[model samples]
Every structure is written in C-alpha cells, then in structure tokens.
Target: MTDMVEAPSGSGWKLLAPVRRAEGWLASVPAALPLLALRLALAVPFYKSGLTKWDGFLQLSGGAQFLFGQEFKLHVFGAQYPYPFPTAAAYGAGTAEIVLPVLLVLGLGTRFAALALLIMTAVIQITVPEGWANFHLPWAAMALTLAVYGGGALSLDRLIGLGREKM
Candidate 1:
C-alpha cells in the first residue's frame, strides 16, 4: 500500500526544483568567470599599448618615449613632472597592465587588483578626458564592476575560501 497526496494549482513549490538545482550547480562554478572577463577586457588595451611601445619587457621604444615626452601630461595635476618621472609613471602603468590582469584572472586578491585597475582607469580618464570616448570610459566601467561585484563564482579567492560572502 502507498499513500498519495495532491497539491493545489500554482502552489509554487513545483517551480522551485529546477531553481534549487541550478543554484546548487552554480555554487560549484569557479569564481573567475566575470573577473577573468573584466581582467582581460581591462588588460588588452594596456597590453597592446605596452606591446606597441616596447618589444622587450619594460623596454620603452622610441614611440613610447615620444609619447611620454610629448603627449602624456598631467593636466589636472597642475604641475609639470620632470625627467625620470614620466618613465616612472609609464613603468607603473605598464606593470599594472601586465601584472594586475594576471592576478585578476587568477582570482587572487581580486578586490585589490580591481581597485588598482580602477585607480589606473580613473587616472587615465582624468589625465585625458578627451580620450574618454575611446578607452578610458570602458576601462573605468569594467574595473568598477569588478571592484564592486568581485571575481564571481570561478576564482582562486572563492576556491581557497577567501572571497566567500560572510554569513
């Protein structure tokens, strides 16, 4: 013998099965998906800029020097940065471009990486408001998203249990 039970229409419990299953499935996904995308989105332009500027790591080609010497300036800073300063700035920017992306992709220290990139994006926007239409705006948007939302479900932060939301 067996017992049978019936539920009223639109009780809503039926709809929960798939949702619960999906939620459970989603929990296993690595936290790096969105973060990786944002990382790549953020990294590419700077990587290309780095590449076109120099063939070797940290080696500034003539075009890079020309750009730093002539085009790059801190208009908002209201002060002229002297020699060795531009190279310093360039090195910092280039290093961030290369290194931060890897960290973001790895989902390690994601918030910090996103914050760094966000700062860089803000500086670019401020330094060249004219270029906002092209690169700076998009970079800022992506960086800000990662800065807020973090590395998502597929990441080292989540894997090692560091980035998980606190109870």
Candidate 2:
C-alpha cells in the first residue's frame, strides 16, 4: 500500500484550511491562563482599595470611616439614605475588600469569594449610582464571571478538587 494520502478534491478545503488551523490554535490554549488573568484583574482594584482602608493590621483608616459614614449614601428611588451603622459598614467592607481579594488571587473558595464581591458591588452601585457606568459595572461583570466560571486548573480549588464543575 502507498504511504501517500490524497488531499480532499475540493478548493473549499483550501479556503477552510487556514480557518481550521486558527481554531485548533485557539483550542490549544489553556483555560487556566485566562482564569488566572481574570482572578488577578478582579483582585488588583480590591486589593488597592483594601490597602487604603487600613493604617495597620486590623485597624480601619479614618478616611475609610469618613467615607462610609459621611460621604457614601445609598440612593434608592430618588431618595438618599445613610448607611445603617456606618462604622460597622466600614469595618465589614474593609475586611471583605482585603480578604476576598486575597482569596480570589489565590483561587481559594473562588466562587464563594466572587459571590461575596458581587454582593458588595451591588451595594456599591446603590451607594454611588453614578459610578455604575465606569467602576461598578465592570466590577460586577468580573465578579459574576468568576462566580460562574470559577477558578480553573491553576487554582487551589482545582488542585484540591473542591469546586470542580463536571463536564
């Protein structure tokens, strides 16, 4: 038998060859890389915000307190309302900003952490409705993406088989 194989007898194959190669190349890319990038992208803003909220370990900054208390307001149906227990809200948001971002970057409890961030994003949108177009919208989208797709193969969740979705 001849080792040579005949090519498909159509010019359509010529046109499709490059497209098929590009598809194959894309398919070869690791899912983990993009997931890691997403995690990092989501983490940076939160981590920076968290850093500003603390003067030292476990100590919330005065500026953070002031913002949550005096500056930030929840806008609801054309009415503005003060945060209930503003100091507590500051502390809670501060802690979450730090902890959740760390968790997201590490890909540990990624979905839970992402969900928590998503909730925080909603609260932030209410607090600063004008930011929706710029900050809140992108953050909400990223958080929701991570919450759904989860940390990929590079994550601790994947290594430990903690929250893997079945194929």
- Give the total clashing residue pairs for model 1: 8
TM-score of each: 0.68, 0.85
lDDT of 1 by residue, 1-167 (tens): 11165544674966866776788778766555556778677767766665676658678677667666677766566664433477767667767777787787787877788889888877776667688878877888887877777776677887887676321
The TM-score that candidate 2 achieves is 0.85
Candidate 1 deviation (Cα RMSD) = 6.7
Top candidate on TM-score is: 2
The stretch of ten residues in a row with the least summed lDDT in candidate 2 is: 1-10
Model 2, residue 30: C-alpha shift (Å) = 1.8
